[model samples]
Target chain A: MADIQLERVRKMFGKVLAVADVSLHIKEGEFMVLLGPSGCGKTTLLRCLAGLERVDGGQVIIGGDDVTDHPPGKRGIGMVFQSYAVFPHMTVFDNIAFGLQMQRVSSAEIQRRVGEGAELLQIQQLLARYPAQLSGGQRQRVAVARAIVMRPRVLLMDEPLSNLDALLRLQMRGELKRLHHEVRSTTVYVTHDQVEALSLGDRIAVMKDGTIVQLDIPDRVYDLPATRFVGSFIGSPPMNFLEGTIRSSNGARALETAGVRLEFHGVPARGRDAVLIGIRPEHIAVERVAVAGGIPAGAIPAAVVVVEPIGPQKLLTVQVGPSTLKVTTPVDFAVDQGQRVWLRFDPSRIRLMDPQTGDAIAS
Target chain B: MTVAEQRLEQTLPPVRRQAVDWLPYVLLLPTVVFLAVFFVYPMLQAFVLSFRSPEGAITLRYFQAMLKDTYFAGALRNSFLLTAIIIPLQVVLALVIALLINTRFQGHPWFLFICAIPLGISDLGAGLIWSSFFTERGYLNLILQNLGLINEPITFLSFERPAWLYGAIVATEVWRATAIVMVILVAGLQLIPKDYFETADVFGASSWRKLRYVTLPLLRPALQTALIIRTILAFQLFATVIVMAGRIVPVLAGEAYFQYGLLRNVNIASAYAVLIMTLSMTITIFYLWLLRTKEEELGRG
Candidate 1:
């Protein structure tokens, strides 16, 4: 296993800069995932690291050696494509042993390594079958086994599980995690699936427009997103944004928004007039309002517009002033449409974002 | 048959079942009638004529006379040699051209158009076009003389130089027919998904290794098709040989044409036709056996 260092890597497709000048360092044996939406250059960056795409203006170093000019085969990296790309003409055994044969390993060694890799992927019975005979999940396993049997210094996967069914994808995801733990190869996985990134990556690099927006652990990426794009892209229902302004009155600053005044001590709101308050769905506390009962202090009044059952939780679409918010509640929390409710925003969970730049305001 | 198919057969009414049985044959009537009239009947007539004399005794006299002819051995030898040489040459040239066109570079369509120009020309036209280059006062000799390589024009298609005549004929045949093979191969190349090449690259396969393992194996069906077509066409090489080399090369088709058109012997012509047809069918079967598809082999396995 070896660490990968990409220094100012840039790739251009004609006039479009697919991957701009970006620098990243992946530690040895770390599962670093590049997470982004489609066409955000996550796959391009992975391709550049794998030496499949040549960098226009930077160096890619693997195991402390500059491999910028090296071919994919010479870069000591094994890649699994989205389409699996297992050779259709060769049997599963030959597909796994292809790189080994190319490296001139002895037949006995090739057989042993192929057997070992097949056992690792639990595809021992499929060794004699062609790619056509295997299912989509089986082909995915063959693709993984083919790459891992090479024992490359760095393993690159470009959404390897996206082709499988949902249940199979989950199963393969667990298998990939277990395989990574067993081999401990430095891996760079590119995917748009935030769940995969959150579950599999040791550190996730959320990218947008050819640049990494935020690089952190999964929890921090989910809870403390650095930008609005990160906040919106990381979650399914996504973070809700409420327009607000930071105002100082009598030597104290507070965010005024939606007919409510919320105060936080640590928000560095100097010289920022327009601010956007971001809160995740599960952070809001919803309480039903009874007739002739007074609303609680520091609670924003709202009406539940829609209730969507999602497994054990119900996602409630609530109307708060002119804005809408999605809140997740337990399945047993019975609430009807158009019912008046009091919503309390978790102050610590609230993120102050700059409206103009779409960046989170440090607090 | 499966139980479902058997059950379906039992469930069908007798009237509809009889209609279904006749439907396929009714659909096939036109093609069968067409083949019998234009193909099978003529083939049978020719076979009978080759075996029997004009008196219709059904003796081997025509075959004996055809075998005793001076050009028989030379015609058979020339036909086999041309097919042996031209099929491989055309296949290789066409494979290279197909691969080049498959790259789809800038102006590649124009390149393919230029390469495929000869496909639009008839065999006689192609032969004449090349003859203009190889004739004594042709462009080739003129260019050579102007370049000061030769003091005098060289005789390329005369009886004195059978090798030069043969080479010129081979060149014409290869140039004229390689396009069809290339078109077939290009279609074949298009059917191959690009992922296999990418996988090969990731596995450290060179261009040669990729062709040897990935491309050639996958391209067997197309290669077989091209080889069979080119071999069958080569056995019938007549107009080009006649226009280029004249009496110098004795191919089967040229011999048949000579006996029919010049000597007015339909029996000898039919015999030559039968010989050429036999050779073509034999070689086509050989190519089909040699390049049987993976699906067929796998089905048997």
Candidate 2:
């Protein structure tokens, strides 16, 4: 396994700049997930590393070798495409053995290695079957086998599990993690799914508009987002942003919104009149009723707009004055639409962001 | 099916089910009628015409006479040779052109449009066009003379040098039909997912290996289709041969036309027509067998 480094790489597609000055260093054997929405250049960055795309500028270093000018084949990389890309004409065995065959590996070794790969993947019985005969999950396994059989210095996957069903994607995600642990190949995975990034990546690079907004571990990325975009983009029920003016009074600070005054603590405001305070939906608790003296610190009075019971948990969309805040609560918690509820925001969870620049206001 | 129908009757109304059942047969009616009127009737008439004599008695005399005719062997040999040479040459040329188109280089649309221009021209028209360059007093001779490549004009389509005549006809046929195969292959190439080639690329496969491992196998069905269509059309290689080489090349279809329109022997012409049809059918079946893809191989099984 080799560590991969992209030095301010840039790629342009005619009039469009696809990847703009993306410099990332992935540690050896680390699973790095490039997470972004469609057209955000996550895939473009991954392709640049794979040599499927030639960068307009900068160098790609692999294992301390400058492989910027190398062709994909000569770079010694293995990739699993989002579409699986299993050679439909060949049987599973031949598909796995393709790279070895291309390298002119001996027949006996090809057979032995292909057998081992099939055995590892629990697909020994499927060796004779063509890609058409396999299920979606099985095809993904074969695709994985094909890549791993080569034992390349790095593995690149471009949303490989996106094509599978929900249950299959989860299973394959686990499968990929297990494979990575066993093989220890430096893998760069590209996906638009936050959950996949959170669960699978050693470090997730949250990207937007061809630049990485946040590159951190999953938990850190969720809890301490570097920007307003990162805070909004990386969470389920996504982080809520309330736009207001930060009014500091006598060493005390408060963010004044439409009909709500959010008193802040332990937050240092840096020259910002307007601020967008972001709070995670799951971090907020929905109280049954507003208590007289027992109301928690940083509480906002809200009217429940909609209460949706999604499986074992409930999502409470409540209006805090003019702004809507989504709150997650247990299934046992009962709250009705049009009912009066108090939202207890986590003071530590509040992230102050600049409204005009959309940058986080850190003290 | 009857049990299902009886069970369905217990739930839904019978009218809807009956309409669904009758829909398939109604849809098939047009094709069946068209085939009968166009194919079955003409085939039966040809079969009858081939065996009938002037006295109206069914006889094998016409078949025997046609086979023994002076131009019979020569005509048969020339047609088969042309097909054997032309089919392979066109397949290769078409494959190269298809790959070139697949590259999608700058001005690829212009190249595609230019490559397919021959498809718009008829066989006879293509032959005449090629003849202008290959004729003794044509542009080819003039260009060669100007370039100091030759002292005098050459007889490219002369009866004496049958090899030159054959070459001229083959060249014209290749120009006319390669585009058809190329178009078919291009469609086939487009159907293949681009990811497969990318996968090949990461595996260190060269251009040749990718073509062998990925492209050719996937293109089998389209290749088989193009071959069947073009080969069948080639068996009736009348117009192009007639326009370029004329009597110098005695091909099967030209012999058939000579027997019918010139010799006024409808029976012999019918025999030749039947032979052409049989030959075409045989080659089509051979090609279908050669490029046969198992259901699982199509990646949809």
Candidate 3:
């Protein structure tokens, strides 16, 4: 296995920059996920790493070699495409054996390795079947088997699970994680689905407009996003942003927005008049009745606008004055639309973001 | 199916089975009538004319006479030789042209347009155009002499050089017909998804390997079609051979034309027509057998 280093790799399609000057170093045997929405250059970056797209500027060093000018075949990488791309003309056995055949491996060795890979993927029974006879999930497994059988230095996957149905995708995702744990090969997976990224990647690099905005472990990416965009893009129901003005009085700093005032601590909102308070849906606790004291110290009274049941949890869209906020509650919680509730924000979990630049304010 | 649906189906009569069957036949009636009057009738008449004696008794006199003719063996040999040389050469050239166009480089549309120009020209027109260059004291000789490659002008279509006459006819046929095959192959290439090539590249396949293992295998149906069409057309090669070589290269179709037009013998001409038709059908069957697609092979298995 080999680590990959991309140094200021830039690619352009006409005048539009598909991949900007993005530099990232993936450790040997680490599974790195390039996560972003469509047109965000994550796929382009993966293509550059695969040597499929030539970088207009900078270097791509794999292992210890500066292989910036190498063709895809010579780069020692195996890629699983988004469409699975299992060669329809060949049987599953041939598809898995293609790379080995291209490498001119010995017949006996090819057979042994193909058998090992098929057994690993649980596709031994499908060796004689063509791609037309395989279902989408089966095709995906065949594609994975095809790539991993090569035993390449780097394995690149471009949204390989996007085409499968939800249940199949989940099952395949677990199988992929188990496979990676067993093989420990350096893999670069590109996908727009955050759930896949969060579950599969050792480190998720959130990209936007051809440049990576944040690179960190999944937990860090979820707990503390680097920017407002990252914070909003990562969580389900997303993070609720409330426009509030920072007020400093008598050595205590507090954020006052609408008629609700929540005091903040350890938040350095220096030189900013207003800040965007970001809070995840699950972090806020809602009280149906007023507390003994009018409201808790950091509680904001709000009326629920909509209640959506999501399996075991209830997502309540509560309006705090003119601004709307999504609050996650237990499914058994008795709360309805038009019901007034007091929202208690976990003070430590509150994030302050810069409205001007969409950057998260340092706490 | 659900029990209710099965019960409904059992309770109801099959819907309009006769009318649906009769509708398709009624729609096909015009085409069947047209073929009967224009194709089957003439084919039967020709078969009768070729075999029957003048006294209304069945005889093989016309076939025996045609076989005994001095030019018949030479014509048959020339026809087989020309077809064997032309079909393979045209297919290879057409595949190359189709692949070049598939690259989609700048001005490829214009390149395809230029390559297809000969397709618009009739076989006779192409023959005439090339014959002008192959003639004695023609542009070919002039250019050779001007370049000092030859001191004397060559008579390319001379009867003494049957090989030269054969070469000229082969060149004319190749130029006139390769475009149609290229068009068919190009359409077939487009139907193949680009992902296969990309996957091949990722798997470390070289350009030649990609062509052999992927492009060619996937292109079987189109290749089968092109070979059959080109082979059938090669057997019927007439106007171009007549235009380029005249009597110097005696092909089967040329013999038929000579027998019917110059000698005023319709029976011998009918024999030649039947021979040409048999040859075309036989070659078509051979191609169909040789290039059976993977699906067809699998189905047979």
Best by TM-score: 2
Order the candidates by DockQ, highest first. Answer: 2, 3, 1
Runs with alpha carbons beyond 4 Å of true place in candidate 1 = A263-266, B1-65, B104-107, B147-149, B296-301
Candidate 2 to truth, TM: 0.93
Runs of candidate 3 with Cα error greater than 4 angstroms are: A290-297, B1-66, B296-301
Q: Between candidates 2 and 3, which one is better according to TM-score?
A: 2
lDDT of 3 by residue, B1-301 (tens): 9999999999998787453557888999999999999989988888998999999999999999999998899999999999889988999999999999988989999998988899899999999999999987789999999999999888988888888888888888888999999999999999888878888888889999999998998898899999888887887888998888888788898998999999999999999988988898888898888876566224232
Q: How many times do residue backbones clash in model 2?
A: 0
Q: Residues A80-161, candidate 2: write the lDDT tens digits.
A: 9999899877899999999989988899999999998898788999999998899999999999888888888999999999
- Candidate number of the best DockQ: 2
Residues forming the 10-long window of minimal summed lDDT in candidate 3 chain A: A289-298
- Candidate 1 is graded, for docking, as acceptable
Go through the candidates in order and give each one's C-alpha lDDT: 0.89, 0.88, 0.90
C-alpha DockQ for predicted model 2 = 0.64
